[model samples]
Target chain A: MSPARLFQGGLVVVAAALAVYPFFGTGYGVRALLQLFMWIALAGSWNLISGLTGYVSFGHVAFFGAGAYTAAILITNAGWSWPLACAAAGVAACGLALLIGYPCLRLKGPYFAIAMLGLNEVLRALVSYFEGLTGGGSGLSLPTLQASVPIYYVMGLCAAAVTALTYVIITSRFGLRLMTIREDEVAAEAMGIDTARHKLYAFLLSAVGPGIVGGLAARDQGYIEPISVFPLATTITMIVMVLFGGKGTVWGPVLGAVILFVSQEVVWARFPYVHQLLFGAIIVAVVLLMPRGVLGILQIKYRLPRTV
Target chain B: MNVVITPAMIAQVVISGLLSGTLYAMVALGLALIFGVMRVINIAHGPMLMLGAYVTFFLYSAFGVNPYLTLPASMAVLFVLGMLLERTLVFRVVDAPELSSLLLTFGISIALVNLAQLAFTSDLRAVEFLTGSFVIGPVAVSKPRIVAFAFAAIITAAAFLFLRNTKLGKAIRATSQSRDVAMVCGINVGRIHLITFGFAAALAAAGGTLIAVIVAIQPEMGQIWTFKSFLVIVLGGAGNYPGALVGGMLLGLIEQLASLFLTTQLSEAVAYVLLVLVLLIRPTGILGGRST
Candidate 1:
């Protein structure tokens, strides 16, 4: 068999193992893997726009929070089922992205980043102010569901779907245009690429996985709050994960999410007091030493596949 | 719910707003100086300001030192800290994409905030140097606030004078205009960058020390000031000093008036709404024709 085929077969085996692990594994093990899958989905979504297009959004949490809120409101206020509400959450987030992305994508560099940051704060305030609907700062609780196994399966599926979509994007002409924009947007426009339209599309695509994952997370937690759903730390973690693994590559976010999530879990269990500080140091070190990330380094040093 | 709108109430809000506005201008001025000179956004500005407040709090609590006297010490400490950071971390990313400096400073900010939490707990601290409020025609002004505003105004004026007249300040402005030209003109651009960052940090420290006496100080309190500073600079125009002052005052007045009509949380959103409006309508800011 060809080396690529062998690698593909190995991946299939790993996926199979992950798919059935919940049946035999301890509850703690299942919960841990579920969280891992969620991070992979979230990081993959972030990587779709930011890593691919080099448009670093500082408030990607807006989408997550929006999705979570949508799902929660739909479940409690409208008496919708979890599956339908989660799908609606993704649609709501996409609508938000399209609306905001049109004007915000016009901004370049720090301006765009700062605008996104302001966007998160604005959305958070708006959610908090609508006390009748959102329960204000006290947060909202959904009906309890004894369905961790189902959640785990759904989250795993979402992660796999995002990874597959990323692979498809990486291999498509659309992704080429995004790479061109990342390299030199003016040059891309000169080459007849609709930079604005393309960026908006990428931004829209990127909001979906996070939105669905957020809905799932809200359901899993059985409670939702603006602060919990819209935390800046979530964006930071996703950004760090993508950067740490290797941005602009198909498999980088997956690798990064797995490694960083496991490390975080281990460190949190051992030294909860110093976890945040240590994480900060890790971020600084990552920026300074591995700006291109681990996959980037391997690709350069060992002639690994560029997309992978 | 027929609330009366009195002239005295308006006057009181306006006076307090302008007072806080002066301090806001100082913080924005610091941010303007750094971005103007280096083209790098210092996300850690808030954390540095927090450190300055912590410094003042510790000095006042430990040695019974006057909070005003601790201003110079805070400024000096942050100046050295800023210079060291510029030399070590910021300089490396000076020419990288704006994202690099932003993320780098963000990392520094996280580290600093968490370190502060570990060392000084998250409890709020305040300096009660002046407790009385003097009434002038139904507009009562707190003594400490008045003092802070006075210092803010004087320091801002002094900063303008330095930029307008001094040799080092000229070099700094020269670098801001065109780094290559400044270098060709025999100016040490690196040294100017170093001094610009340190000077900016010192200004933020001054604002921190002054405001520490008026409000409760905490490790996370700097985040709001950072947002406020960004709003002021955005409204004023990046790197425009006079524009920043005007913008800061406008924001202060707007916030004070907003609280009258909306909840405090919604009032806080006013800055963000104003920010979005400014960005969409006038990206060059209210003071037009400035290049970002």
Candidate 2:
């Protein structure tokens, strides 16, 4: 089969599977599926910048936190509608992305990661420090209701839309420039690609899906706290999911999110300690065995040509 | 208007900062060594330090082993762990892209920190060595703090001697300067890399043990230390030992003085501010020569 056909067929199958999942799995399963969808979106968004552009961001939680805080504050204080709040949250997150990326993105390699890490910590500290605004460490709780199911379906659609958008970008001329920059920034710069603009664009694009997902997550949970909203673990999990599934590939992060989340839940339930150990071990093993991730391994085994 | 900063207070801050800075230097030394020799930024450096602290904590708390005695044992175990980690995980990505090495190490760091948290609940653990204080002129410094300082200084000196005088140390240095040339000259670059990684881990372990004695030991303690060490390494410039020492000391002093005036919370931000200033003014660091 042609690559494009295979891609479309896979997406159709995945979408159909998702549509039927809530019914077969029940309410609890549906909730899990919602989480999976959110994570898939987060991981794929992370991949857009870190994986494709080769700029590792240790501070993605900042954007995620921004989205959560924006939505939560608007809904609770201003009494905004959920969809509008989400849109505001996304815009807020994008604004934050621009604020952070404008200065730090100028540095290369681990410097960017360090800057992002600092930014995340600074955000967390600032949020927690301002008790009057962010409710301090106690957290802000929203009203709970049975409206989460529709929200789940909406989130799933958003995840699918974002994934499709990423797919298009990956196959387009912009992606070619991104890949070239990733391969060698100096060479790309020599070839007349404005490295700074490309990186900023990638960073901004990467922040959008996660921002929306973060808003969805806050609404679904009906609460938001600095710790929970800005959890470093979430960012780590997203990066791990992307890498484990196969970075720089369209479907890799989706596959990774599903696999890691399901396995993590199972592991967390049975033996928590062993589960964490295994998580760490898997990262070590994956780095050693398949530095390119699962899709990379598959490509190597099957002699598949590289495709977005 | 005369605002007097007492000599005793200044002495106290200097003493404390030097002790803490020595430990920071020790931790960053290992990081600097590994980065200098292999060009591999071991994000796992902090986790390894945490592991060392935990190992010592367990040995001391569970089996009633003295922390000082268990320190060497922890270092030895960590050395082996580091070697195994490099051989199994890091070796594969040695030739891969820089991002691969970075992401791989970062993954290992996350896994280790989470696993540590899972294994040992997020509670602070410490070993009380000597709590009494001794008077140095008008300033009084804690006995354990002094001892920890002495231990750090001794280790730093020993490390310097080992790297400067030993044949293996010379070989490692030779390899670090030019890997291809070192290989051409019949030096086992792989062996040097392994030893360098192991040595770095050992230094981290020693620092961890001492830190546990000095302060609280928790799973996430390494995260702060990791960033602090990065600031030190960048300030000292990668691969410059003396620079790390000076950088670490300056960082410690800055934090101490800043805390006296600003809140402790702001002290960390101060470090980052200092880092930014250094990066902006002199990216090679204050004492960093062209040797690195």
Candidate 3:
């Protein structure tokens, strides 16, 4: 195999080893690992649209919530299998994302971000309003003693697939077009890059991974609520991860998710106040000190040139 | 059960919404002031307001200071905080891409909210002000709300006067109109920016303190107000103080009236819908002429 292919193969092996870590580590470690995988998926999908396209969507949690709620409602009401429910949930999320993104994406910059935030609140309100279906704020519960192992494995696979998809897209011509649009939409459109079509495609593709993870999350937790599933914290954490890792890079958000989740768990357990304080301080400091993130610092240290 | 909707109820909703909208306007006034002068959307305005409430909460809890009295103290403190933020964080990103500013402010917001939550947990707290009532013909209004409304109006008016009459305010207005021209006229644009940001933050602090009295105070309270303030800014016109007042009152009325017909759950959504409609139809907003 070529050197690049060999390197990629080796990286995959390492990642796979990391994925099976719950089998060897403590139960707590397993839980943390599961959370890390979930966050990694979230951050990676977020990077697709916000980091790469520079759209800065503040409402991605809506899709995730949709997926979770869809899966939960379907499984409980229709008695569908978990996998089928997961697929259906993902499809439902993608459809919703498309519907929300079409009209909203026409706006640019902070306007888009505000619209997304509003959309998320709107969705949350709607979910709560339809109390008969969603169980409102009290939440819905999944079947007991189902299968945690299968969910973990699915999460691992989903994270890997998402990372691979991101890598592929970043290397392809579409990635270049996206980068161009991010740099300057007017300029990109002048160059015949249909910015809207590309953005929709990225937004739609980005929704799929989060949807799948949300489904897995619902299955694993065996309970879903509008608050837990569609927490604004989810959006903030994903943004922090992608931002702390370096926005447009593939490995950046993954590294971010791993480091942030681990640190959060450690700090949250000891001196919760200090941890929370540090959490906010870290975001502000990182944005001000290292706009490119930890990976960006590493890139500079290693004298690695930026891709875009 | 058919409930008769009376004129008294309509009057109450209108008065309450107007009061609430005034608070929203106070918050939006700060945002608009900063945006007007600096052309930077201070996303952290909400957090600063939250901080004000927290400060007020602590002052009252620890030393038994009246929350109303804490308004000036909080304003002064937040003003300094604003100055420091502008000089250090916002100044650096002033010339960066719009997205960078957005991200930077967002980071500041996250940091502030989390820091407040860490310090004050997530418990909801309220400052009990006046518990009495005022008679208006057959309609009786709570004294604190009326007082809060008066406080908002007075502060808003004072802010307008300060902006119009003071030397520093004139310099700020000059800078807002054109930074290059203001600099040519020997106006210290940097100082103008610093003072403007501080003034904005002070406005937010005052509003936050009053709002704390009127409603519950929590770390995330600012998040809701932030968006609502944004709606007010858009509705009123970003830079115009008068626009903020009118916009705030309009939003309050809409929300209160809507809540009477619809559920309280959907009450908040009305602001967003109005915002979207305004943005689509009139990007310049109701007051118009202010730059985004």
Give the per-residue Cα lDDT of candidate 1 at B153. 94
Off by over 4 Å in 1: B1-4
Span of ten consecutive residues with least summed lDDT in model 3 chain A: A272-281
Question: Which has the greatest TM-score?
Answer: 1
TM-score (chain B) for candidate 2 is: 0.95
| CAPRI-style docking class of model 3 based on DockQ | acceptable
- Error (Å) of candidate 1 at residue A218 is 0.8
lDDT of each: 0.86, 0.81, 0.82
Off by over 4 Å in 2: A1-26, A117-119, A143-146, A265-268, A299-305, B1-12, B62-66, B114-123, B135-140, B272-282, B288-292
Inter-residue clash pairs, candidate 2: none
The candidate with the higher TM-score, 1 or 3, is 1
Say which docking band candidate 1 falls in. medium
Model 3: colliding residue pairs = none
Query: Which number leads on DockQ?
Result: 1
How does the DockQ of candidate 1 come out?
Answer: 0.57
Candidate 2, true inter-chain contacts retained: 0.33
DockQ of 2: 0.37
Evaluated at residue B11, the lDDT of candidate 2 is: 85
Candidate 1 per-residue lDDT, tens place, A86-158, comes to 9999999999888777766776656666667667877889899999999989999999888789999999999
